[model samples]
Target: MSGHDLPRLGSLAWEPALDRPDLLAAPVLAALTAWAEQDERVRTQVAVAPIDPDHADTATLNAVHGLPTEASANCVVVAGRRGDDERVAAVVVRATTRADVNTRVRRLLDVRKASFLAHERAVAESGMEHGGITPLGVPAGWRVLADARVAEPGTLALIGSGVRRSKLLLPGDLLAAAPGVEVVEDLATAIDA
Candidate 1:
């Protein structure tokens, strides 16, 4: 995922005010950048400034070419359980592809149940501020899983930067390379072609 080899998704027309370097100066950004530096497979190809109002779902699709065919996909991390202790895990699926958490992840994690963590707890425990939650800065003990559809060719996702004001465009394969990530099909529903 070196900046050199990254194929242009499309004309990157947007001009971000890189002047405000603070946009990516947070701890979460540091962690994500560190991971990207360590692995060429799971690196951040580009960091895009999220719209002030946050049009992430649509903006992410538009930012990349040959993507966003009818429906969009994203990777989300949910805090769950591991041996009676709370933990976090990621699930990648289309905006149209819902993760059947109650059924799929529960069985996968061997937990009696699974649910989206409370917003407050998610922000605090993940060490990432709210709206900026990305699997990048997730706690070490947590597990990650991506729906196989995430690996589909040309798939793009809107991943958080540990801050809501910004996001990064990540190829499905690169996302799969996130630390401790477990790629699986357990969390997705099919979309008609």
Candidate 2:
């Protein structure tokens, strides 16, 4: 089946992954592209879309593109410090749920406190746009913590392609198995609509 044949992605205007020069320019995205090329599971499953950089945020993107909230996922960079050492993780959760940073994340990192990484720090460290820090190509040694929901088979997760101008759509299980990624339960708490 063609990439567009993937469920939940047929509605979006997806361009061939190799054709997106804008996405390949970003270091993190470039890394992801290389990784996908090497991994058959990801090479056949991923799709990319060029979007308005301004609407990259989940709420606006969903409203404008008519995508379901559940199909979109958010990648948040979280940091915790233990004395001289710092631990960083990219937390992936569905847009409908918020990462449990204070409790679950802190416990996982074994740090006294856990909080979202500062915007500048996140961008500088990941070498990606602020609104597009995906877990796929974060700095080596950083943990990628994906919520269990993101790993459910057949779930199409809309996530950042490491740039605000584009997004990636792929099977949740594929993302969960990305290099150094860990699928954790209760990583996020559902928000009441």
Candidate 3:
């Protein structure tokens, strides 16, 4: 479905991402623009919304914007090291789940240990705000691992547009097919109630 088909939210105006470069990071804008050019679905389906920086966290964003928690996704940067070599990846999962960094991610990365990247490093390296690092514009060579649940067709993931002052909304399937994204089974485990 296209953005025009979706209901409008209060105050948060939805617009084509390609039309608002100021709301996105350089790399993210480049990638999304390229994808929109190459795929008609992307051009019509992707949307962006300006948000209050203070309410950028998933729960707060959802509550204030009337978006559902299940429709949100979180992208976390993880680092793994073996000897002198270090590998970093962006792990994307539903807001209802947490990345399985200790076991699955560590094993997949083939590193001795896997841990969340330092907050400062993640923000600086990604060229994004501390709470707004996303898989779309992460530094090159960093893997993007998305949990299977992130690809469900009807679900729209409200993800960072590389900044805390705005957010991107797109179908999960589109995110799964984004450049460098790898949809992995059981990449995240469900959170306890």
Candidate 4:
């Protein structure tokens, strides 16, 4: 994508707070922030904001919390063995839609079958509390997959802070900050609300 094609998040309507806690300051956010800072191309287009922890879900999280849904999106990381194989991979899917792990993801990851990582294992492996896991700060040796839709220029994404007390609004460029994230075109299939 051309530099001009990149969406400058400042154009979007988002609020910033001087007193608000830094969502990226947490382990997850810190890791991601460091990564962005290390890359000039990514640092230029990235931004972060704090949100209420209760607003974790995309549907009601924004309404009661009084935030812009357009600026918030969900992040889900799934890890498990294939159908009958022992291979394990982490799949990241957006909250606006569910990951088609049962079909699309399993095939894309080239695993026999896949399932959500157990609560204990997820938190343990990610070193993040449940409800606060972001693609950032994940331990080394794990695979990262992002929804292609997230790659759309100017898109803002809601990610966890490694803690359940807050969230961060980061530029979509974060999708590129990770080491091995693949933007899958059909990773997420819409579900009936």
Task: Give the winner by TM-score.
Answer: 3
Candidate 2 per-residue lDDT over residues 49-127, each given as its tens digit: 8888999999899988899899899999999999999999999999999999999999999999999999999988888
lDDT of 3 by residue, 52-108 (tens): 999999898888978888888999999998899899999999999999999999988
CA-RMSD of model 3: 1.8
> Which candidate do you rate higher for lDDT, 2 or 3?
3
What is residue 45's positional error in candidate 3, in angstroms? 1.1
My TM-score estimates for the predictions, one after another, are 0.73, 0.92, 0.93, 0.74
Clashing pairs in 1: 132-162, 132-163
Sorted by TM-score (best first), the order is: 3, 2, 4, 1
Ranked candidates, highest lDDT first: 3, 2, 4, 1
| Winner by lDDT | 3
TM-score of 2: 0.92
lDDT for position 187 in model 4: 83
Name every residue pair that clashes in candidate 2. none
Model 4 lDDT on a 0 to 1 scale = 0.60
- TM value for model 3: 0.93
Cand. 1 TM to true fold: 0.73
TM-score of 4: 0.74
Q: Please, what are the lDDT tens digits per residue for candidate 4 over residues 41-81?
A: 44443444444566555565667656565555555656556
What C-alpha root-mean-square deviation, in Å, does candidate 4 show against the real structure? 4.5
